[model samples]
Target: MNIKGKTILITGGGSGIGLESAKQFLAEGANVIITGRNSAKLEAAKKLLPSLIIIKSDVENEEDAIALLDKVTSLGGIDILYNNAGVGSPALNLGIANDQILKNAVYEMNVNYFGVIRLNNLFINMLKSRKEAAIINTTSILSLVPALEEPTYAPTKTALSFYTRTLRKNLEILKSNVKVFELLPPVVATEMTANRNDKKITPEQLVKALVSGIKKDQFTIRVGDTKLLYVVSRFFPKLAFNLVNPKKIYASLK
Candidate 1:
């Protein structure tokens, strides 16, 4: 899928990865629409990237997703739907209390899973009608391997990975032109994980890899340590799993 002149809807556009994606897409001359729950954040994005179409939305809410898709598609045909909106919560292995663990799991699932689901469902038809359409889902290294924070985030990515795959399979069954893609990005120097020194890749490097994978030919856009996770997840599930356990391996959050 060509990024130039294409219209793309992005969720979680307030800050971090989502915001960065919006800026990069705009620079590439793609018609970008960004969504977030905070009006202030949306306004801030607008201030920073005036070319962007900003929408205040909570992708976790089904109705909000439907409304957002409707609003954007009505303006013009949608060529790409980048489901970049996501949340990361502490995993049960992080050893938080039971109540916090439950809340964390739910929060992560709501933003990471259902948020993408709602957008995919609503805009799929519109994208199908277009000449060429694509979907880019934001997954993580934990989806393929366990991280100390895996319990909170890995399941959501695992679920999302399956969801994207099934959708692609269904598209084949229906003979649809929509191509699906995923990113297994390693930790980046973003606000969500700025403290980490283990990861050397910058968001620009990751985003560059992302744009390179925007074409339909790309499937899994794995970069940096993320690829290692797949290898580890496959060859040494238990050993790989233990490495990220906060209790057993490293309790240090930073």
Candidate 2:
């Protein structure tokens, strides 16, 4: 799809991938609106890219999601709805309190899974009105291969991957012009993992891959080593599991 002249709304656009994606979209001549829970971060993003339209809205809140949709639609209908907001908890063990796990689980599911569904349901028909439009749901490589460091986070992304696949198939069955794209990125150099020393792709690299993928109509856009993860998971499931699970290292030390 030609990204130029399209109106795009990206969630969690205050930082990392979202922020970089928004910047690139603006460069591509698209109108971009970014939403996030933190007003300060959103303000900072706006300062960096004065063309950006920032809305402080938490995806975890139904009210905020609804208000965001209305506000963006009023500005101009959205051609791309990029569901990119997500959260992660520290690696957990079964010994953690059940109540605490449950609490974190609920919040993660609400933001990562249910929130994407809600926005898509709210804006799908509006998207159809445009000549060409897309809904980009940000899942992760973890959705394909479980990551030991993010047990809770991985499951939520996996659920989102499932939902995005179904949504794409359903849209095709309806012969709709609305396209659904799933973005699966491996660990990237972002604020979320600033202290981590692992090899990671830059946000600029991700945005470049994403834009090229979209232009060519690649529905499942896997960035960086995520493509490797998909391959390993398909043919070497056990090896893939061991690679991502740090617990395997402990077992090796013994």
For this target, which candidate reaches the highest TM-score against the unseen true structure?
2
Cα lDDT tens digits, model 1, 125-170, are 8889988888889888777765664577888998999898888889
Per-model TM values vs. the true structure? 0.90, 0.95
Estimate the overall C-alpha local distance difference test score of candidate 1: 0.80
- Model 2 scores what on Cα lDDT? 0.89
Worst 10 residues of 2 by lDDT: 245-254
* Candidate 2 C-alpha lDDT tens digits along 1-254: 89999999999999999999999999999999999999999999999999999999998888998898789878977999999998887666645466666777788999999999999888988999989999999999899887766768899999999999999999999999999899998889998878666788999998999999888999999998899989999999999988777565443322
lDDT of 2 at 177: 96
Candidate 2: which stretches are off by over 4 Å?
95-97, 247-254
In model 1, the runs with Cα more than 4 Å from the true position are: 91-97, 195-197, 242-254
The Cα RMSD in angstroms, rounded to one decimal, for candidate 2 relative to the true structure is 2.0
C-alpha RMSD of candidate 1: 2.5
